[model samples]
Target: MPGKRPLNAAIIPSAKRERKAITLDIKLEVLRRFEVGEKLSQIAKALGLAVSTVATIRDNKEKIKASSQVTTPLRASRLTRHRSAVMENMERLLSVWLEDQSQRNVPMSVSAIQEKAKSLFDDLQRQQGESSQTEKFSASKGWFVRFKERHCLPHFKVNSTSPGSNADTYPDVLKSLIEEGEYTSRQVFNVDETGLYWKRMPEGMFISVEEKAEPGFKSSKDRLMLLLGGNAAGDFKLKPLLVYRSEDPEALKGYSKPNLPVIWRSNKKAWATRAIFHEWFTYFFCPAVEKYCAQNNLTNKALLILDSAPCHPVNLSDLSDNVRVEYLQDSTADSMQPMGQGVASIFKAHYLRRIFEHILEATDGEDKATIREFWRNYDIVDAVDNIAVAWEELKPATMNSVWKKIWPECVHFQSFSQTDNIAWLQRNIMALAKNVAFEEVVEADVGRLLQSHEEDLSNEELMQLERERAVGEGENEDAPPALRQLTTEALSVAFSHFEAGLQILTSNSPDEEWKFKVSRAINDAINCYRELYNEKKRRSKQLS
Candidate 1:
């Protein structure tokens, strides 16, 4: 052709290409332009990258942001090398080891790090039933250096005791801040995340004995990670973030993403991770904190407290000067976290209570004997809705009292305590459970429901959860599928709700305009349904 371009690396016109190392600023700017309605190809060309690179940025924005967290105010490169060793698995393993070592006051050397990495990899290979290599991966000095930098790991000499061991210093630090007037009660917030088996009963009471003996008795094992954020004063509460285990859970199949009731996210493992945490900080926590401060006429300064969980970002960058993060000492969160004090338990009680209330409502004023039949169909969607309800129902008074230990000055007098609320839940939940389950079972469940939640996720369990599994694929889900296929009786029940609303409009409205519109909508719907039904019947006869 017109002096064919020198075949430099032979542009083969194939899908395969080397991944580019894009700078964080470039990726972010591309997304900003996308939000402002610029074309991806245009943005890519301007940035001197392929259009597909721009598209990738748009597609996995959260992943990109997490990978790119800055170290020293530099726009760090976020691009990661494609490798057989899954970074997610590696991050979790290394983080757990680091935290454990930190708590033990043990400093890690480069060689030590390599040894651990090799051990972890070997163990994983054995678990996966892959033949072990004749020689283990070297995890060489260069690799260790890169790994340490990538994870922001420090290699200083051990001088002081572990964070877990030096419990006294943490309280001293917090108390000093209060005495110094560094932050007010309203400005102090404790944010902690915990796993919840949303559909789980206190026991396997939901499972039949036959089903339990048959195989997987995990019908109620649906889990979610709930991040609760609340101030010591309890005057303001940030909306809780719920992270479910699937990319697109069946419960959220038809919902509009932008109009969700909660700041929701998802991961394969329902457990929390740094990537998810970073996204939460950047998008949900920062904006909400700013809004809360602005509305309350409070100073913009806020102190957010977090525990040293493995998934928390090593350096949460770009937070404004007014916002500061304080990590709680290791092993002391149980004693120090405000959310742990009572807020989480209270919310869980209220969540269970909400579910019971739902069960009651579903009964339609029927005898309690029918509660069992009506309650069997509750799913993840019901649990999620109840989670929001439970979080909202926690009284400010109850939440404020939880901070009494550390922030006694901020603690205001309240008529009731968490104990009273727990008693109430136990009483009510026990009564409700008895109506549907065995009395002995109810007792066991009620005890469990009231107890503090446990963290029992093992490493292997987490690794198993991280493995990719296709969920609800290939099933033909109908577009515009009704919330549920309506029964004639159910339809009649629904009409009563509509009729009640229409009657209110008729009685309260100044004119017939509202009534006319509703009537027209119903007629149009009925006529369309009739036409569709007739066409379906005609097609069926022709096919026969």
Candidate 2:
């Protein structure tokens, strides 16, 4: 809440109004009340809203007025027309880019787009009087930049090795498997390491013009590293990766601490040790791979994908003969990696959600947390725990069901050329949009259905249950039996919702009937525990 800013209250034009009718109405009502003599508090109370809503409405109104009024008097029509044309062209370009994001077929480079926009202003100057195209160019440039930033970026892919190498060549063994049609539609398990930072600015932090910082306002100096991995399914398994800073080249000689932070000013021991990589491989990567293979009944013939990180050893002699590592091209992960495409994003989203929930819980329903204390005390162990819980909550069957809807024409074990792959990706993305639309419909219906009974539990009871479930067990015997009962009930409810959502999203599939059974189990568990908790609560109320 410390960094929170007021929302905008400005009225947009007719076209914009149609695009955001509900939001526009809310903003208008807030602004209308604020314009009256009523205080912000009174207006918020009248509207059944937070006072911050009034503040946002006022801020937005000011921003709209400021942005709409041109400082230089050049007929407003000309500026509006130009802006409209620029927006239309941008939308057209975006459609083209989305259709084929091969970098070669995209309409214009970033520089070319800027130049074309600049030239529009130049043309305007020639038609009217001499004026600085700087402001208009800047505005148009910002719009195009945002458009590209949002919609035009290439898909994320992770491959083994760097680009321009033969590391990506499918081995003869793999080719043979493909030819035999043994690898078609089979699950691909990809393992990679990524670093997570404590107190790092989250992805997509949008700062507006008013709040824009001067250059060099922030530095990436206080990042903490975490190593994480997942497969095609968006599951995450993470471990903390250590970092050391030193100017000295030889200071590594006496380093023996497992989690020690070492710093050296002189060039005595600056080079990173190979032992660190070996340690990660032995303690984290190897064990995870082995365990996963054993648990999943994956034979040695399953495809394993990895990047060319320096820490990844060149030789994998410890792995069985049937297991082979497929190296990806460098810098091309945005195109080939499943984790880069989906899993990593999902993991990061789940991580941030958990972090926000934790912060809210710690602050006793307050949204603020001491940033420094959060970073210092934020244990990677806890983060891993959160991620694991979220992974279990993932509805893989739902995703696969959705994928099947979109790629109905897809054939397995076919050698899809680059063009074929691109077409499939386009179709798949389109299918995903439809799938989400269907899910949104289901979510809306569920919301309506659950609205009446949603308030059966008190806020305090829910929070207490959540906390006890997270902690799992008490260290002291003094802990109340009711608290443990509530925890069990809450966990059952949580898992029930998770499983129910999966069931709804996946609907009916012979292959996925097990999911429905799981959901039913969770529901039964919740009902049993809730009955126990209700009996306890009733007894406590009678005693009181």
Best by lDDT: 1
Tell me the tens digit of each residue's lDDT in model 2 across 191-281.
4433333223322222112113424222222222233344433232334343322222242455443333211111111112234444554
Question: How many residue pairs collide in each prediction?
Answer: 0, 33
Judged by whole-model lDDT over C-alpha atoms, candidate 2 comes out at 0.41
Model 2 spans > 4 angstroms off: 1-187, 201-220, 233-287, 296-301, 317-319, 365-544
Query: TM-score for all predictions?
Result: 0.55, 0.32
